[model samples]
Target: MSLFGDDELPPVTARESQLDFWNQVAFERVQAQFKSGSMHHALLLLGPGGIGRETFAQELAQWVLCQNHSQLDSACGSCKSCQLFVAETHPDYHLLAVEDEKTQISVNQVRVLIESMQESAHQSGWKLANISDVAALNQNSYNALLKTLEEPQPQTLLILQAEQLQQVPATIRSRSQLVALSVNEQATIEAWLAERKGGMTEELKLALSLFPQAPYKAEDFANNGDAVKCGDFILDISCLMQGNESPLALAEKWLPDIEDCCLWMLLMMRDLLLLQQANDKSCISLQGQTEALTNIVNILNNQRLMQLNEKIVELRSLLIKKSPVNLSSSWQALLIYCSQLAQKTAKSA
Candidate 1:
């Protein structure tokens, strides 16, 4: 089930970052597809953010271009073709992604990829093109890419990485061999992380509760020690929510995990909803998170909580817009709004 190579193919011992169980499952499925001669010309990998679909897709490409394409389940990592793949010099293999943060994968990139596929492969076998973050494509780019899918090159494989599958056009979806990537279960992810020698600190647990399926992301926090900063930020957040300090002033000092802070707030909001729904206090899922959510929930009633959650959602939408707002100011505004609302809740309660 190792995504990097086949079961018979030797395991990749040189890997630094680890792939989770679900990623291995995806690898196994891709291997099966190749072995059965049922591999589609186009594959669409859909999944939640932070799931290892990009890594899975890259490994799947290597498998497809293996020189000794015998069993079909895996790539012979030692083969000449595989070497080229590893070196990223494989003439037949192409990857297209956003050119930069400001620009998307333009129609020109798609055009070049499609044109390259029309030519013969360096290994004279299969051709692979991985277009990552397919949803990042503009309307013109998607339409341009659609033509290539309708008339795919022989012995060619196209992989699309879709984080927001809903945003992709239906035409692209219908043509692709749809593969859904899911987060590994909590136990599975924890075991995977433990094997990778992660410290498994409380911050990691907190991130897992928020991100849930992406252990690598949890490991990221583990490596950087951002959890401690988050802990401090949460304390300041609690103070701001309680009107003991200015929200804007607190935002200036709490900068390590700005994104994590947003995610924590969202997760805490969900926990508050759970608290509201539960008949018994012990039924709350936020057991370890009690200290974090207590002040967050105390500041807002159910309706105010809903509105605050909506603001978080709106912030995410604004982030996706071509023009992003000043993130720090945005964060400060959110904190101030929540703090003011918290005061109202205290008065009402």
Candidate 2:
């Protein structure tokens, strides 16, 4: 699963940088809890994907485990605990998540973490376990976790991060305090990107438009050529709308990365919806494709656009859930729907 891929965990330094702008508020909340000595044993950090929820959780875990964290709630970099954390070998810290290519975190994984909680803290400080994707916890895993959450471990902090709170079991959510994170202002994000990368490119701008809530991901997409692929996908779909491309051919071409293609199509459908409603264009994801989107809006009415939007959303949801799907068939079906909508529009015209 892409959500739990074998990507290396960002080092403490990288995580610190990732949390630069969005951390202060969430950090302050955790700090206050720490100061009052009433910190919740389990904290659920809720936010959109790519908005650094996991990084925030890691930062909070470090703050709790740091032996010499000052009153300002900052981790003292020179402390032994801080060093161990930076080295990603903090004996008192544990990270639990679905392994690479796994659809869910297994019961065995949860049991191991739970058993680890039974041991004493290695450094006589807080023992922190950060669960990166709480939503990916299977039923058995969740039950195992629920048991631990119900029976609190003193000085043990469990940080749960998920994009959607509704996916988490109600019993577990009720036990854990919730902290929501969101994107910073556009200007703030752009300024940060400029400072970090020396300048912003068109790819970065489109990435920001696509993932406004996640500056880090936007930057990554821009740097790693994913942003360019997204652009090409948009252009290809625009060609499809013009009847110049075969949906089956396009679907076959994008079979390897159909999830991303679906995501791009969803965003394009969103832009078309906005344009049909005469909403502000600033909210559109495909910044330079306004002419193509406007042409699409001209071809489709609001109702048709809405129907297409629903179809695209359903497809995206299925892809995200890792459901068994025939990608080519699905894409062809969507294209057929679009073709039918266009025909209906022409008849009405």
Candidate 3:
């Protein structure tokens, strides 16, 4: 499960292949800064989730603490500091993240981390702390961290990762230097995925499109049999709209992946809306299922699609917020609405 206990978001990959391939450019930029003595104390890595920012941060930490080589721009795994880091017992490196069964990092966690950071590193003099999701820090937690952000601890590096910058404060943003990471080379990612055994080229490419800028996530989707699951879901949605599948059964069947189901519904509705609005297939996201999506476009009007979209959005918000909700029943109503809308349109035709 992902940090949020949802499979919709992919966990950060520790694969050396991905950490090196996807983030080499970003890594080199920071390395250059380090070599030139211009590296900032606080580095904020901004990117979409699953693009290897956290892995880059971890590897960079090891590289910084490695005693054997500073010229290689990477950790020499045989070095003492590198060994300690690999074992996750390095005294200088700290990882701050949301606690289990909790949504956000607490102020107390921040205080404890900050207190430890004040002390000299027991092994390497360099102090490194990585906040996995800086956006998950609440206002109080941010306030608790402000002193550390404003002050300077010699050789201290704070690696902060955030998917949403709007949730971060202006003060924090000003104090940290932002590093952006993105990938537009679809062919390169596809080529990489093709090299993996048990991965079909066609399905891999389809997953690639679904997770834009997140190639590793696409690979995870394929490896976890999510592509097949998603295919079944698409078929189920088509069957529902065509008045074949019952909404209750489909909803119950998909209850375990409720959040993902909501997301897929939203994306499907988004595709349908775009198809109706622009009359262009390129405007839709589910490119592999153009025929089914086109038929969906005909099954519902813009107003109905928008209505269904609003409900999906609301339910997804509730799920992400961890609010109490009757997901199975709610999803059944959503599917039933789609079927009723299709039946009404068919009768009119």
Candidate 4:
């Protein structure tokens, strides 16, 4: 199981091959900064989840703390510090993240890190910290971190991994130098999945479109096999949105997994937008739902369709927070939204 109790993310060693390119790029950048004497106190790495930002951060931390660092570039991997890092017991390094029982990174955790950071490194060299998913910091936690970032310790390297850069404060963003790691191109992701012998689904594609920043989460959903069925259900739901037929009749029969249904709603909204904006069916993943796509296109305008997608995102986030989510009500609201959109479009035409 992963940190969130989700049985996603292949074991650490399995992820190495997929992360080579990203790690090389990040390592080079860090080396360049070190050579130029322009290394910042905090480095924010913005990227999609599971495409290796966290892994790269770990490798970079190793490079920074390696005792046999003869070059400004790479870690010797055989050095004492590198050995400790590989063993996950490096005294000067820390990883701050929302572990079990912690919904968000709290001020107390930040305080503990700050106090530890104030001391000299165990090896009397660089202090490397990886704050995985910095966006998990609440307002209070963010404020708590401000003083630490503003007056960082000497020879300390802070690597922050965040899927949502917007959630972080402007002040914090400005204080850190950013290295943006983008969503792995389809080829990259497909290749990674291929290596893992993991199967993909249309739901995975839909999830990619809906949650671009967290492709592995989508991959996990796809691997479940149940989510693939939910994809079919969403296509049916899209068809039902075309007429006066009540989706409520089928909702109880088909909504086996509430999370999957909500995810389907999110993807359907995305498909609605894709149909509205893009003419080339070959360019996007529509899962051969062209008839349903046509119906949605005839109904939704760009803005309202976008708003519908936003609502789905809101619902997904609520579910992630373990909040009590009402999927049936959300689905009913979506049906109403689509029906109104179709009616308005027909009237205008």
Candidate 5:
């Protein structure tokens, strides 16, 4: 869903940068709790990725650390603390995430962060740590953080964020206050995109259609010409089905975008599988290629299609976990399976 507001929003401000429209309710509740001096030391802001949970955390942190709540719980943006936060030089604030090219947080990182939060704040106010994608914490990382979680420092703030909340252990969940965020409306998100991307174009529609309820992702898709690439992808799948495309070359060409390649393949196979069972477009994500996919679905070996779908799921999971597996050969084999999907039926005939 869209995070930024349209015409209804006031002029730009430091607070505006962090306060996404969909996050207002959660923000207000936290703000009220803070004002009442009953806010918890540790908080788990739970929501799907691209739904503005990160921004919500930032806004909350800025509010808590702001020496002057010059605008009703929003940061003043002029005080020393606000200035330091904006500069990313605040001695009292820390932002933690999975290190670059690495998928999970390390025990050492967790230990260091906990130690920093345990110290006296240089500003003598609040010491804060915002852990993005906290689900990336491994068992050892979690163990390192448990002591601090149980005995949270006074006037300290620890904000944990995760898209897949199930990945978080129940022990951690029980310690922190959880806030689950939801979007305003799909139409509102679309309107915000239209205003920013210059009217509701076909690319915009296709992007949003591809990534439902993930407006930022949709915007990224539109910006990156994935829409055209998707059309190309559909054509390549049809060509492969017709024995006009080589699986080896296709895999090589798609290796750079293997994750999306696998994802699109899965979604397309899903559409094919659905059409095999019933002629339904409502559940189709790649709506633009419905007719093409429907035509392609008619000749393939249905059982092989199901197996290919399953294989894609398995590979996709490996990619999501950043597993150290040989996917190059897997990709080639998967595409070979797809390329020959229609062959079995033809031979049987």
Candidate 6:
């Protein structure tokens, strides 16, 4: 299980194959700042989740700490610093993230990290601290960190990785330089996935479609058979919308992974909405299931699609809050709503 107790894939580390393809430009910019001796004391790396922001931050930390970093900005694995980093025992390097049983990074944790930052580095170089999820920092934590950001220690670098700038406090965001990472081109991601995971299949394609910015996640989903499960879900939902399958049975089949199933439903409904507007198959995410998707799309109007989308979004919000909601009831209601909309659309047609 991952940090969140979910079966999601782990974040890619510095040791993972050379930085993600999309990180090269951002890497070069930082390398230039490093070379010029103008590197920011606090740097914010922002991007969509699962797109390697944390991995890039780790890679930057390693490179900055390496005594014999190459011109190409690669860390020398043989160096003592590199050794400690790879072993995760570097005294000067700290990774602050939310731990188990914690919903957010507490103010106490931030204070502790601030105290550590005040101390001299054990090594003869920069003391590096990486906060993997800045969004998890609450208001008090952010205020505690804002002081440190304003008066950073000498030769210290703090790297913050967050999914978006909006989640960060304006004060903290202003004190740091932002480096945004985006999804690579489709061809680039497909090529990388093909090389890493052997030949590309329909499962891989669909996974890529679902997580276009995070190829590592897409690859993981494909490798772990989640992609196949997603494909089957799309087909099942399509059948249900066409009145060929039972929503109750489908809901029962998906209860084991209700969150993922709901996500798939939202994506399908989004695709249907896109199809209704664009009248094109290219806008959909379920790559090879255009016919099925089109059938589902044709049976629903934009209003019905929007309603289902809203319901799914609300269900997801409830799940995140860990509220006392009956999962089966929520699923049943969602399916019933979709079935009613489909029937209404059919009668109108």
Better of 1 and 6 by TM-score: 1
Q: Which candidate has the top score in TM-score?
A: 2
Clashes within 3 Å, all models in order = 1, 0, 0, 0, 1, 0
Off by over 4 Å in 4: 1-18, 183-222, 226-230, 239-284, 295-335, 339-349
Model 3, TM vs. native: 0.78
By TM-score: ranked, best first: 2, 5, 1, 6, 3, 4
Q: What digit string (tens of lDDT, one per residue) describes model 2 on residues 162-224? A: 877666779988999988888657899898887788898888887887788878888888889
Clashing pairs in 6: none
State each model's CA lDDT, in order: 0.74, 0.78, 0.79, 0.69, 0.81, 0.81
- The lDDT of model 4 is 0.69
Model 4 poorest ten-residue lDDT run = 9-18
Q: What is the descending lDDT order? A: 6, 5, 3, 2, 1, 4
Q: Write the per-residue lDDT of candidate 1 for residues 1-349, one digit (tens) a residue.
A: 7686555654443323234457787778877877888888999988766787777887778767776656435565677677888898989999998876646888888889888999887784899899888867888888888888999888999999886656567999999988888875778787777667655656666666766766667677666876566566666767777888887777776544566677666766777877766634464434554676666765666898898889987765555442246887887788788788888888877
TM-score of 6: 0.78
Q: Could you give me the TM-score of model 2 versus the true structure? A: 0.84
What are the per-model C-alpha RMSD values against the true structure?
6.0, 7.7, 9.2, 8.6, 7.2, 8.7
By summed lDDT, the worst window of 10 consecutive residues in model 3 runs over: 9-18
lDDT winner between 2 and 3, please give it: 3
Winner of 4 and 6 under lDDT: 6
lDDT of 4 by residue, 1-349 (tens): 5677445522222112234563566667766887677989899887766556877787677767776454535566665567687788989999999979767888888888888888898973889778997778777878888888999888988888876666567988999998877654666766665456455556666556655545566566557774557556756666665664565655565555666667666666666666667765655455656676776666667876777677768766765544456866765665566566666776776
Q: How many pairs of residues collide in model 3?
A: 0
Candidates' TM-scores? 0.80, 0.84, 0.78, 0.73, 0.82, 0.78
Spell out the clash pairs found in candidate 2. none
Clashes by residue pair, model 4: none
Q: Compared with the true structure, what per-residue lDDT tens digits does model 3 show for residues 1-349? A: 6686545532222223226486888888998998888999999888767787788888888878876435465676765677798999988899999999998899999999999899988875788999998878888999998899999798899998886565467889999999887886777777777787455565676577677677778778767887677767877888888888898888889989887677677767777888999999986667677888887787888887887788788787766544557766777787788788889889988
